[model samples]
Target: MNSDDPLSLTSKTSLGAYYESHHVIGKRLGQSFEEGQRGPLLKRWIGTGRRVLDLGGRDGQLTRHFVDGNHVTIGDIDAGAMRLAREALGVDTVEVNLNEALPFADASFDVIVMGEVLEHLPYPHLTLEQVRRVLAPGGQYLGSLPLAYHWKDRWDVFRGKKLWMARDPTHLQFMRYSDLRKLLSTYFEVVEIVPLKGGKKAVRWPDQFARVVAFHARKAAG
Candidate 1:
């Protein structure tokens, strides 16, 4: 593959392969999910008793929290993660590439959860369009993003430092909190938006201080 060519679906598939070897700092790692940063927010926002689609939810780690009493289908580009989510949680799985349109029927789910996955997409706006299309009227969209406008990072740029949020090359896009908010508002109504790891300062100025932001938004009824 030409290095200049855009990241291919095969490359994205390879990226998903990493989930099999690693787990986050929460319940998947035998630690308390509730104790982890932003854990309480995710659990509270993602409730049960409805159909849920977990975009890029690899290996049933974060999906386990609301899996019970709610029917779930995990969509990912990784075949290994798809098989493992089924083996781990007995949930349905679909192999999907978010760069393309979603295959589900219109208004297919009561909720859609996309966590830390959008930044890796070169076409986030396109994917979020599908997210809006698949969600049932008034259904929720729950997700998180690494805030690109963190004050420290801004300071670093002022001091002539170059940085990327993580070592992972898949993170293809970064935007200020306001930029993200505007994009999301195109499809979903902002119900609540909050910061993670931003502390008291973030409460007042999330766009300036938050390391990440979690959100609960609603699809408008037709």
Candidate 2:
């Protein structure tokens, strides 16, 4: 079983089943917060009426925000999740394995959203390279990743609260702020790095203790 293959769930682990069962309910709670908190920021960066891809978008929860006045497509490895996304969000979807080359034509998207997906992948650099390939010139790729060692997650571990948001077995990679910038710079020119919730002041402080950080990166125009 290739760990890099996003569809390689052949290990028959309970994790896939857990995601299938909890994808909807869990995302309901999560999407509410994200829509209220992060959606506006992403919209500001993404603008309106352009091709957008939500990579690893489970159940198209986050895809809903962009659908009203824009073209949105979702890609994920889970068939159940993709089915739910199409049924619930009424958006286009394609099966994808992040470790493998994306199944889209070159420069197929104007904007790409990759929220809370990088930390789960085994090869983030390769994923970013593929993202670069699929993105049009000057296209934007927006993403979010949790801090590698947040104090709250540490507290959660201390309290043995390993349920739901507390801990995830699927999180294979942990990264710091510097690590994120460096990684994305390999394939993109990072234009902005901001906090998921707080506004401008958070950018000044750039809290290392924060749970997650979001970014806006662009493909260089040839």
Model 1 per-residue lDDT tens digits across residues 44-68: 7766689999997877677787888
TM-score of each: 0.83, 0.80
* Candidate 1 residue 83 C-alpha distance from true site, Å: 1.6
Query: Per-residue error at 24 for model 2, in Å?
Result: 6.7
Model 2, range 41-76, lDDT digits (tens) per residue?
777788898999999787776677677777889898
**Candidate 2 displacement at residue 215 in angstroms:** 0.8
**Most accurate candidate by TM-score:** 1
Task: Return the TM-score for candidate 2, rounded to 2 decimals.
Answer: 0.80
> Local distance difference test, per candidate?
0.76, 0.75
Model 1 is weakest, by summed lDDT over 10 consecutive residues, at 25-34
